[model samples]
Target: MKTILITGASRGIGRAIASKFASGNKIILTGRNKPMLNDTAEYVKKNGGEPVIIEADLSNPQNVLSLTKSIDITQLDLLVNNAGIAVVEPLAEMTLENWQKTFDVNVTAPFLLIQQLHSIMPKGATIVNIASIASKEGFPNWSSYCMSKFALDGFTKSIREELREKDIRVINIYPGAVATDIWNSVPGEQNLSEMMSPESVAELIYTSVAQPSGTVIEDIILRNLHDF
Candidate 1:
C-alpha cells in the first residue's frame, strides 16, 4: 500500500482527504490537536486504512525536524502540505507576531519539511501543496494570509522544476473558499451554504494523485459554481 502523509489531517480538507485514501493506503496524520487527531485515526481505521497519528505544531522548527526523523520518508509515496494558519485584520491592525506565525506554519514549515524529506523520497513520489485563491489575488484584511499562500505557490513552482529530473510530481491546488473552521477566525458573516464542501476538494486531490504515472496533473483550481 502507498504511504501518504497529510499535515493538519485532523479536520476540514485534510480530514476529508484522509477519508478518501483510507480504504486503500497507509495514512500518516499530523496536527497539534491530539484528541482531534485521534478522531481522524479512528475514522481511518474504520475505513480500513492503517493510520499513524503524530501530534505536531508545524510552526516549531524542531517539531518539523522531528517529524521527518520519525517517518520513513524513503518509503513515502505522497506528502500533502495541508497545514496552515491565517490572521484576518487590516494591514495596519496586523501584528508582527501574527504575520510571522502565519508564515511559519503556511510557508516555512512546508519548506523545511520538504527540504528534509525530498532527498529520501522515491523518484515517483508526489508532493501536493494545498494553496488558495488568495495566493493569486490580494484581499483586504488578509495581507498575511495572502502573502503566505503566495510564497507557497512560488515554492511549489520552483520545486516542481527542480524535481523534474527526479520524476517527482509537485502539484499546487488553488481552492476557493471552503466551508471550514478557518472562517471562524475571520470577523464577518459568510454564506456557508455557498462555499464549496471540503469533500469536493478532497476528491479533486485524489483524482489528481491517481493519474497514470506517465501523466502529471500539475495544477488544479476549484471554485464554487455559485461564487461566479
Candidate 2:
C-alpha cells in the first residue's frame, strides 16, 4: 500500500482527506493539537489503515525541521503540504508578527518540508500544494494570506519545472470559498454558510492523488458552481 503523509490532518479539509485516503493506504497524519490529532488517527485506524500521528506546530521553523529528523520512513508515494494559516487584515494595519506567522505556516513551512522530504520521495511520487483562489485573485483585507498563497503557486510551479527529468508529479490546487473555519476567523465576515463544504475539497484532494503516475495535472481550481 502507498504511504501518504498529510499535514493539518486534525480537522476541516485535512481530516476529510485523511478519511478518504485511509481506505487502503498507510497514512501519516500531522498537526499541532494532540487531542484532535488523536481523533483523526482513530478514524484512520477504524478505516483499516495505519496512522502515524505527528504533533508539531508548523509555524515554528525548528518544529518543521524536527518533524522529519527521527522519521526513518523512506520512499513516500505522496506528500500533501496542506497545513496553512490565513490572517485577514488590511495591509497598512497588518502587524509584522501576524504577517510572519502567516508566511511561516502558508509558505515557508511547505517549502522546507518538501525540500527536506524530496529525496525520500521516489520517482512517480506526487506532491500537492493546497493553494487558494486568493493566490491568483486578490481580496481586500487579506494581503498577507493572498501574498503567501501566490508564493505557494510559484513554488509549486517551480518545483514541477525543476523535476521535469523525473516522474514525480507536482500539482497546485485552488479551492475557492470552502466552508472551512478559516472564514470564521475573518474580520467582520458574515454568512459563511453560503460557501462550499470542506468535504468537497477533500474529495478533490483524494482524486488528485489517486490519478495515474504518468499523468500530470498541473493545476485545478474548484469553485461553487452556484457562484458562477
**Candidate topping TM-score:** 1
| TM-score against truth, every candidate | 0.97, 0.96
lDDT at position 62, candidate 2: 89
Give per-residue CA lDDT, model 1, range 114-167, as digits (tens): 898887778788999999999999999999999999999999899999988988
lDDT of each: 0.91, 0.87
Cα RMSD to native, each candidate?
Answer: 1.0, 1.2
Residue 8, candidate 2: Cα error in Å is 0.8
What TM-score would candidate 1 get against the native?
A: 0.97
Worst 10 residues of 1 by lDDT: 68-77
